[model samples]
Target: MLTPKQARFVEEYLIDMNATRAAIRAGYSEKTANQQGPRLLEHAEIAAAIDAAKGARSERARIDALWVLQRLVFEAEADLADLFGDNGELLPVEAWPLIWRQGLVQGVEVLELFEGYGADRVHIGRLRKIKLDSRVKRIELIGKHIGVNAFRENVHHTGLDALGDRLERALKRNH
Candidate 1:
């Protein structure tokens, strides 16, 4: 559960407002919104609650929420799917981007997803760490577009758990 102010900020941000805008709407200084916005979003419980709300969200609202969530994580837009199936499947193959900018091709749908997301160049500094090839990552994206089809019917909508699992496994394999 978020504080009233925090909750209001999240609610406003979910509607397509940036942190600065949301902060202003939530009755905070626009400058403070930048500092406070990331802190509020960093709360694990708050994130979990937001994810729960987004899971059952109407298709239209869900898409909107996806835009906000992508901006929150990657600080940029993403190509995440819009319509989720009743069986809890992502109808759209597009997933979110990871700000990866590289010259090598990998099986990473997040690259193309970012391109589709209309992510801004405002924060290219932090996003520069990702290494996505100039050429589309065809093989990586061929079957992993959604990156969460691994779930059965009881699947979670945002697929964070699945993604975390994959990331953890990859990290273990790497080191």
Candidate 2:
């Protein structure tokens, strides 16, 4: 069981996961909130409460590690070809597949083309640009989560290899 202030702190902490801010919002003195926040978290009851709250939130939102991984995989596999029609023109948003509409596209820019200037201008076709989230970045994130080094540049040589070569040359010279 927690006091009202402690319960308030738990609720406030859930808002942003910032202890100091939660402490202040929970009515702790600003001068001591910085210390009080972490101190409160150290209590077993508080920690358990926080865990319960997080679990409940995740359950309500239907989000977990598996859901996150699935979303990342979808983003990484999203194809731009799906956004175009048979004639190579971009398809309307309504025509896009649900996966592309939901996750792949970051934004859409439509620039209305016109003929002439000012009052003499006549309406023309519009230019549509679709901004896609970076597939490479999504793959990288998925790789990191799964412990795969997709984007990491690995150098295979250990410094000991060079040292061993130098030692071998020195021994040959002495022999």
Clashes of each: 5, 0
lDDT of 1 by residue, 1-175 (tens): 6779878777777677476677678888776777876766677876776666566465545566456444334422222332335675534324322333221323333322233334563423212122333322333333244454443246457988999999999999999
Error of 2 at 109 (Å): 1.4
**lDDT by residue for model 2 (58-138), tens:** 999999989999999977776779889999999999999898888688899999999999899999889998888788888
Candidate 2 has its poorest 10 consecutive residues by lDDT at 149-158
Work out candidate 1's RMSD over C-alphas: 20.4
User: Given candidate 2, what's the lDDT at residue 49?
Assistant: 95
Error of 1 at 166 (Å): 33
What ranges in model 1 sit over 4 Å off? 58-143, 146-175
lDDT of 1 at 107: 39
**Each candidate's TM vs. the true structure?**
0.35, 0.75
